[model samples]
Target: MTPQNTAGPLPPPTERRRLRQSRSLTHAQLAAQVGVGPSTLRAWESGRLVPHGSEGETYTRLLTTFAAEGVTAVDGPTAGEGASAVEAGRETPQAVVPQPLTPAQAFDELYAFCAPALVRQNYLLTGRPEVAREAVERAFQLAWQRWPEVARDRDPGGWVRAAAHDCALSHWHGFRSRYRRPEPPPADPADRALLDALLTLPPVYRRTLVLYDGVGLDLPETAAETEASTPAAANRLAYAREALAAQVPALAEPGELRRRLRPPATSEEVRAADPEPVRRKAERRNVFWTWAAVACTVTIIGATALAVRSAPTHYEAPIAPAQAVQGVPPAGVMGPLSREERALQAKLRSAAAKGPYRLVPEAR
Candidate 1:
């Protein structure tokens, strides 16, 4: 089925009226089927307003149902389809036509269509089915919360797919997975080996490979989503491809690798997957990291300030040269002694004369 473009405005009133008439149903009946008031239906028919959200979805589905059932009004002809009755010169009932799908319906259809592929991509990236399911669920929940932005996006599927991949690589995965039971490994030996090889690669390399090779994203796109430079992404892809070829030579071909890594289940099977707990956990982790960073910054600043405040200051002073001792003569000196030195020598001699043994001077 062709993917519906949900970003445009509603269909014209004349188109809506023609479809309703072709169904041979009154405006009130059609409105009831579409879960709207008769007046609302009239407004749509008169071009005063248009259906949006779920109402627009209802109109699309109801008209599609009519066209599939071949329901036609007793009128002459329907819209878009040529007037066959006029050519045949016969009066035949007008047939109802399909209306456009609304953004909400289109989003639902996109989720159902892309979820399985996204899950598989995540699974291949992380080597864990449970983690992949968690990732898909979280990505979808975020898409639902931001449907307006997502619907208008150029590649909504790529956006969600990238998000799912990130969720699979979240830092809290280890803590979150502990409480859950482990899923069984893939039955295929080649797949198992491929997954093992993929798991062994660094997260960036693995993600780049998956987005580029597995998901068929171009180098620039992969780089943009992975937040890496284009050159870096290309290098990573080359390394991952070479490593995978070396590890699992049997599945060296890109097509074979994608086939082996494709998701096994449909999105409907895991539609009930819960993402609230995971989202909450991620929020908590972010809060904790923020506070931790703040605490570290404050501690560094405080330590620097304390060190500057407590350091001691020092000053230098000059020292005078040592003075000669009063009774000691200068080394190697034959000159006469100074007045003070002579007086000291006479006192020493007087003391010596009074003692029993006089002191004798030794000549050098």
Candidate 2:
């Protein structure tokens, strides 16, 4: 049977299976042709998954090509019969399978797809093409060294973008910007004005603005890459937009600024890219310093508490009544006593008579 037209809605799973059968191609064969895993093709045929983004478009194009080519199944017994024959010790003609791309090949493809856009993103951040080129090159070089880890990442491009951003913000760039002459303005008046306005903003605001508007990252992603909280990123984006609008009224139009600032390439369009490099080293150092400071603080506090708890306390001994009165004269004085003293002696005699009295000889 002839293949269905691809201009209409996507063919159902049954139709895909029929088309594959008509072409005498196994699931693995078709998947290899399309540069996807055999399981992915099986999922598409089973209706368990639907391709999206570039994958979906690729599927449509492949299906269209398959229909146009009018490939037909070779004359042969059913697959079950062939398998049974093989089990019975009968040899079946083997089909040559396409080899999968190696890791190096995959890395090359990924770098080719993502490097240009990443370079553009860095350029926007640093306002210098040379700095941007160096940053992107450094990031890709690191990715090449850690290809396995980077290949497994879901958003490898994001990792590379963050690394390049850090490189652009490195201290060397600051020194260079201070000592070197500023680059000439662009020929376009609007472009020149926008660049000038962006340069005037604080680094945090500028980075937030470029990441959100120019790089097409969502608020949370921008915040993560910038190492800011979501709320803080939102605030920065709002302030940056307002500042840009004030300076360039044309930017006040919704999406106009984003359109003007956004790079020609997108992360979605380029599914593969490099890994993060310098950020990991910086993060490790930061973690070590933080733990060291915490340990020192806890040690000091514990020592202070132990010292206070184990400190010695002083107490005074109680004095005997006789010793307390040793410096005073006897109750009966030789010389005339003051009126108040005589009254005190009379009160003391009364108390002494009521209780047991003790007498001590007067000193010579």
Measured by lDDT, the strongest candidate is 1
Model 1 spans > 4 angstroms off: 1-97, 177-183, 262-364
Q: Model 1, range 1-364, lDDT digits (tens) per residue?
A: 4334253444566766777766545553465456555556777689676566666677766666655566444554575344666667676564466687776576666665677667777777776667778778778777866778977775677778778888989878777656256656667676677778988899989898877656555577679889999999988988888898998897678767655544352222333243445345545666787899999999999999999998867765669889866987668868989999999999997888788686667799
* Per-residue lDDT over 1-364 for candidate 2, one digit per residue giving the tens place of the 0 to 100 score: 4244344456788888877765645554465345454567788889888765554667767776767666444455688897888788776666555466687666565566567767766656666667777787777666766667877775566666777778877777656655277765556687677777887788789899887777656677678878999999999999988898999899887478877776442222222224333335434656787899999999999999999998877776888566353568668747988999999999998887676466655799
Q: Deviation in angstroms for 104 in model 1?
A: 3.3
Q: What is the C-alpha lDDT of each candidate?
A: 0.70, 0.69
What is the lDDT for 50 in model 1?
55
Q: TM-score for all predictions?
A: 0.48, 0.50
Candidate with maximal TM-score: 2
